[model samples]
Target: MAIKYKVLPRKNPRDIAAPEKFYAAAIADGDVDLDRLAELISYQCTVTATDCYAVLHSLEHNIIGELEQGRIVKLGRLGNFQVGISSEGKDTATEVTTTNIVKSRILFRPGKRLRSMLNGLTFKKAG
Candidate 1:
């Protein structure tokens, strides 16, 4: 099955001329929630669906716990996830404090296997 994309017109942010460019943005085919994911895993493994759900739920809890401690969580063959922050800049290094932090976000970097799959993906225009 091929991945699908939609062509979108985006304004060039760097150009004052405001030239419009078309970009191919992948369209989500569908969503697989936790229950569905567990069922799929169970079909391919000896573990039961209930066990798969339990393990996946445990993983979610641990990932958040480690990230709260400012640690990067690596999911081998899938990706690495880490916390990213946006903060107000201070003129003096000593003036910087936790209060300066504006927001926190999760950043994911795809591992080699995941990235390699992208190379084989075929795209079709979305309806």
Candidate 2:
């Protein structure tokens, strides 16, 4: 199956006088929540849906716990996740503290397998 996208007309932010140009934007197929994901995984392996759900839930908790302790959580070929932050610049080294942090986000780096899967994707224009 191929990803579906549609062309959209968007104006340039830097040059408001410029004519709007068409851009391809991917249209989401649908959503698969945790319960649905566990069901799907069960079909592909020996694990039961209940077990898969439990493990996935545990995985989520553990990842957050590790990240809070300032550690990167690596999930093998699935990639790794770590906390990232944006902070205000400080003039002096001692002036910077947690108060300077403006935002915190979780960053995920896709592993080789996931990257290759993305590279192999085919796209179809949405009707």
Which runs in model 2 stand beyond 4 Å of their true positions? 90-95
lDDT of 2: 0.96
TM-scores for every predicted model: 0.88, 0.85
Estimate every model's Cα lDDT from 0 to 1.
0.94, 0.96
**Cand. 2 TM to true fold:** 0.85
Put down candidate 1 lDDT per residue, 95-115, tens digits, no spaces: 999999999999999999889
Off by over 4 Å in 1: none
lDDT of 1 at 80: 94
Candidate 2 lDDT, 32-67, residue by residue in tens? 887888999999999999999999899999999999
